[model samples]
Target: MEYVKGKPYFCYCDGKIKQYRYLDKDIKCEILIIGGGIDGAIANYYLSKDFNVVLVDKGRLGMSCTACATALLEYQLDDFAEDLLKHMTEGEIVLAYKMGIDAKGKINNFIKTQGNYCNFALRPTFLYTNSFFSIKSIKKEYEFRIKNGFNCKIFDSNNSPFTFPLKCGIYAENGGGEFNPYLFTKQMIENSKNQNSIFENTNIVQLIKNDHGYIAVANFGEKIYCEKVIIATGFNWEVLGIDDLCERFITYSIVTSPLKDFTWFNKALIHDVESPYHYLRTLPDGRIIYGGEDTIFKEKPINENVSNKKYDKLEKDLFRLFPEIEGETKIEYKFCGCFGSTPNNLGLIGESKIDDDILLFISCGANGIINAMAGVDVIKDILLRKNNPLIPLFSP
Candidate 1:
C-alpha cells in the first residue's frame, strides 16, 4: 500500500540521513530483517549486538510509515483499561499495561544511551473527553489506571487547561514522550553499520522455508540465506502472505510554523476520547503538530480536493481546541498516511503462524513505536532461548 501521501514533514525537514546500496549479490546471515523502517531498525540495533544481522528495505530507510509517524512514545493504549476489561481478565490487563510502561522506559533509556540524536524528550500526556457523555468513561479509565499502579490524575472541566469545553481528562505522567522518528531510525541503522549490513531498494519477493533455515529471494533473484527472518513490514505485512490481522485506516496531519507562544500546550501530548480523535503535540522548535481525522481505507487516491478538506477539518479542530492560535499559527506542512489497529488495540509480535522460522512484528494502534521497541526486546529474548512472559500478550 502507499503508506504516505504528499511530502512528509520529517523527510522535508531532515532530508536523507544515509544511503545504502541495493542487494545485488547473494548474502548469508545468522538473522535477516525485512522492512528497514523504525521496527526493522530497532530489531537491527538489538540483534546486531549479539548476532550477524542483515536488514533490507524496498525503499530508503525511515522513509516509509516511520517518517510519516507522529512518533508519540506513550504507554497509553488506544483501548483503555476499562474497555479492555470486557475482553481480558484483570491479570491480563495489568500485565499489558505494565509491559507498556516498561516499553516507555526502555525507549527513554535507549534514546539516552544512543546519544539522543532524535530530539527525544520525556513529556506528560493529557487524554480528555470531547463530549459530556465521555466523562463517565474517562473517569472510570482514570480510576482503573490508578488502581493498577499507573501514574495518572483526574481533572474535571474546572481544572482543565483548555478554554474549550472539556468534561474531564486523564493526566498521565512518566509514560509519554516525543521524538524525531526518522532521525532515530537513521541513527539506529548507523550504529549497526559495523556489526550488520543494511540494503535499501531491495525487495524480498519470496520466502521459502527449509529444514535448516529459510531462503528469501530479492527482486533481482538474489537469495538471502538466514537461520531466521524478522518481518517488520509495518502496515504492509500482508506482502508475506500472513493473515490480514489488522484493520487499516487513513489518518491526516498538519504541522504549523514555529509559534512564538506554545505554552498553552505545556508541551504535553494531547488527545481525546472521541473516535477518530484529534491529537496534538509540539516540537522542540516550537512548531505545533496535530493529526487525526481518520477514515476507512478504500484505496482512494488522496487527490487535491481530499487533502484540502482533511487539512481544513484538522485546522478547524485545532482552532476549536485552542482558539488563541487561530491567526497566530501558519500551517507549514500537511500529509496523510495509513494507520492500522487491531481489535484489542495491541500489537502483533511473535512467531508467524504461517512459518515458525519467521517472526512477525506488527505494531498496530496508537502506541506503535513503543510497541515496536517492546517487540524488539521480546524478539531478542526469543533469539537467546529465553522466555519473555509478555510474549503471549502480543502473540498472533
Candidate 2:
C-alpha cells in the first residue's frame, strides 16, 4: 500500500467529461477499468488480451484531455539530472531512462501492427536551458543518455547553430516523435470496440471490495464484478473519490501549425532552453504546436479573457521566429488539465493502498504516449505476479 493524499476523493469534469452519455447497467469482468483517457484505453487494450475487461469513463473515449491537444511523443529526458538528483539516485535514473526508451519502441511497434494513421513519426528531441547552471547538468544527462544506448548529441551555440542566443541543449535522436492525438486515440477506441473490450460514455460512480473480488457500480446503479480496478482518470482521480491523490499540478497548452516546412530547421521537434521549458513539434498537416509552462493550483482559470491573454503572449513569442505569423496564424485549439505529479515528477503506478484489489496508474510530469507501454509492463507484472522493470520503482 502507498501513502495517499489526505483529501476528499472526487472527480471534477470539464465540459468534455459531462458530454458523455453512458449506459445504466451492471457489468462484470476480470479487470474493471476507471477512466477512458489514453492511459486507461491503452491499459484496457493490453490487459484485455487475456483477461475479461470492462472500462468506464465519464465521457467518450479519447475525447477528454487526451484528444484536446497535439501529442508530442518523445522519450527525451527533460532536466534529467536535476529531476534524478531530487527524486532518485543516478542508478534509478538510468533504469527509468531505459524503461522510457523501451516503452517508446513498444508503442511504435504497436502502431505499426495496428496500421494507425496518427502520423506517429520518429524524430529527435532537443532540450536546452537558458541558465548556465544547466550546462553541467545537461552534459551529465547527455552522457547518461548515450551511455544507455540512445542516439544523442550535446549542443552549445558554438558547435551547432548559434542561430539564436541559446546557451546549451542536449539533442537525442530517434527517441521522440509527434502525432495527432485525437485520431490516434480514436483508432485505439475502434480497436478496443472490435475486441469487445471498451465501454463507451460510461460514468463509473463507485467501487467496493466484495468477497468475489471487486464490484464496479455505474451511475445507473448498474454493477460489475472484477478481480481488480485500474484508475487512469488523469486530473480527475480525486474526483473518483480516491483519497490518495489530492495534490494536483495544473497546466495549460495550445496547438498551432505543424513543423512541416521549417524555414526554421529540418527537424520537426525542438524546445527553448529555459525553465517552464517549451516543447514544440509539427503535426501531419505541417502545423507546429508548443506546450509547457504550468502554474500549480487547486482550480483552473477558465476564461476566454484569461486564456486568450496567455495565447496572445505565446503568439507573440512564435512571431519572433516567423515574423510573418504575427497576425497571419490563428489558433486551432486550446487546452488545460491538471497532472498528478509525485515529489519526483515520476508517475505513480501499481496497487493502491485504498484497496488491495485496486491498481492506481497515474501520468503527470512525463509524456504519456511514450510511457504507456511501460505502464503495460507494470500492469502485466502485477497480474502475473512476476517481477517487471517498472514494478519495484513504481509500486506503492
Candidate 3:
C-alpha cells in the first residue's frame, strides 16, 4: 500500500512507527536482507540485479545512524595519519590507503554520471592540534602523502585558518566531500524494491533452521524463508542473536545550525587533536556538523532524552572555530548514536559460522557509503577467487 495517506513521521526517534508484529506466513526468496541500513541498501542494489530479494526493516529505511550521522565523508578514519601509521605496518598502511581511495570511486561513480541529487560537494579537509609536536608532524604527514602518491599540502597554525595553537594542518588536497546521506540512501532503497516481494515496518524476531535455507521469525511468529540472509540492521544485531556486538560503542555525532561561510575554513572537513578529538564538516545546506566526544563509558547509551552535555560541548567546540556562532545560532537539534567497533578498526565482511549461507555483515566504523559499494562486489566475487584476478586481494 502506498503511504500517501499515512501521516508524516520522523523515524529518527524511537517509538515513531507502530510496533509491528510479524505475521506467520510461508514465503520464499533467493536472498533475504535483515537490516535497512546503508550497507543493506547497497547489498540489495547489487543482489537485486540477479537474485530475488526481500528486505525487512526494524526502523524506517535510511533514518537510523545514517540520518542521525554528522555526515562528513572523509577517507581518513578516526585517527589521523600521524597516530594511525604507528599502529599499522608498511603493507597494511598501503592497503588501507588504497582501500579508502577505491571506495571514493564506488560512491562517486553514480554522482559522476547519473546526476544524483545527493549533496555531493567538493571541499578542503584539514587536521590540526594544540601541541607544537603535533603541529610540526603534519608537515611530515604531508611529505608522506606525496612520497606515497597522495596529493597533500601542509599549513602551520600561523598559516592555517584556526588561531588556536601551534600545530600545522595537513590539507587533503580537495579530497574531502559531504552529502545528504538520508536522501542518497533512500533513493537506493526505492530502486531496490520490485514487484516480487517487499515488507516494511516489519520486525524479525528470530532465526531458525529450515529445510530450504533459513527461517526469519518475525514478532508475531511469521515465517519468511530465504536461501540466504544479510544483516545490515545497524546496532540491531541482538535481535538476530548476535549478542557480543551489543557492547561496542565506536563514535558519536551532532549537527549545528549553518555557520556563515568563511575564507579561513576554506569549506573543508576538519578534525582536531583534542581530548575527545573534534571532527567538523559542512552540509550542503551550510550546517556545520562536528563530533567525536571519545573516551567514556562502554555500556550501551540510553539516549531517550536529548543530551544537554553534547549540546553544550558542541557550542563550546564551534565557538573556538567561529566566535560568531557563540552569540548567534544555537544548536537546533541533537541526537547521540553509537556504532560497532573492533580492535583493528577494519570492516568484517564475509560468511557467518553460525548458520550456512545465513549471514553477511557491514562492520566498518563509518565509511558506510564507499565501503558498502566495495563490499557488494567483494561478496559477489567471494565464491570465484580462483578465476577472478581481484578476488584474492579481498578474499575472506
Best by TM-score: 1
Write down the RMSD of all candidates, one decimal each: 1.8, 5.7, 5.2
Ranking by lDDT: 1, 2, 3
What TM-score fits each model? 0.95, 0.87, 0.83
Per-residue accuracy of model 1 over 65-177 as CA lDDT, tens digit each: 88888988877788777778776788887877777778778877877777888888889898998687888888888888888788888777678765667788888867688
TM-score-wise, the better of 1 and 2 is 1
Across residues 1-396, which tens digit of lDDT does each residue of candidate 2 receive?
011111100111121222334655665688877878778877877777777887777666665566544466666544465566786777777777777777767768879899856667777777776678778877877777777667787778788653545678877766577666656655565566324546666667777778988777776777787888888876675435754473664345656633434444445477765666666665555555655665555443444354456566666666665665555556665555555556555566788877768887776554655566577778778888987767766765
lDDT of 3 at 275: 66
Candidate ordering by TM-score (highest first):
1, 2, 3
CA shift of 327, model 2, Å: 4.6
Q: Pick the candidate with the highest lDDT.
A: 1
The local distance difference test score of each candidate is 0.82, 0.64, 0.61
- Relative to the true structure, candidate 2 has a C-alpha RMSD (angstroms) of 5.7
Worst 10-residue lDDT window, candidate 1: 296-305
Quality of model 1 by C-alpha lDDT: 0.82
lDDT of 3 by residue, 23-139 (tens): 346688888888776677777766787778887776566656666555566665555556665656645655666666676666677577546666767666777776766655666
Query: Which residue ranges in model 3 land beyond 4 Å of their true spot?
Result: 1-25, 80-88, 136-140, 161-166, 193-196, 250-252, 260-264, 295-306, 383-396
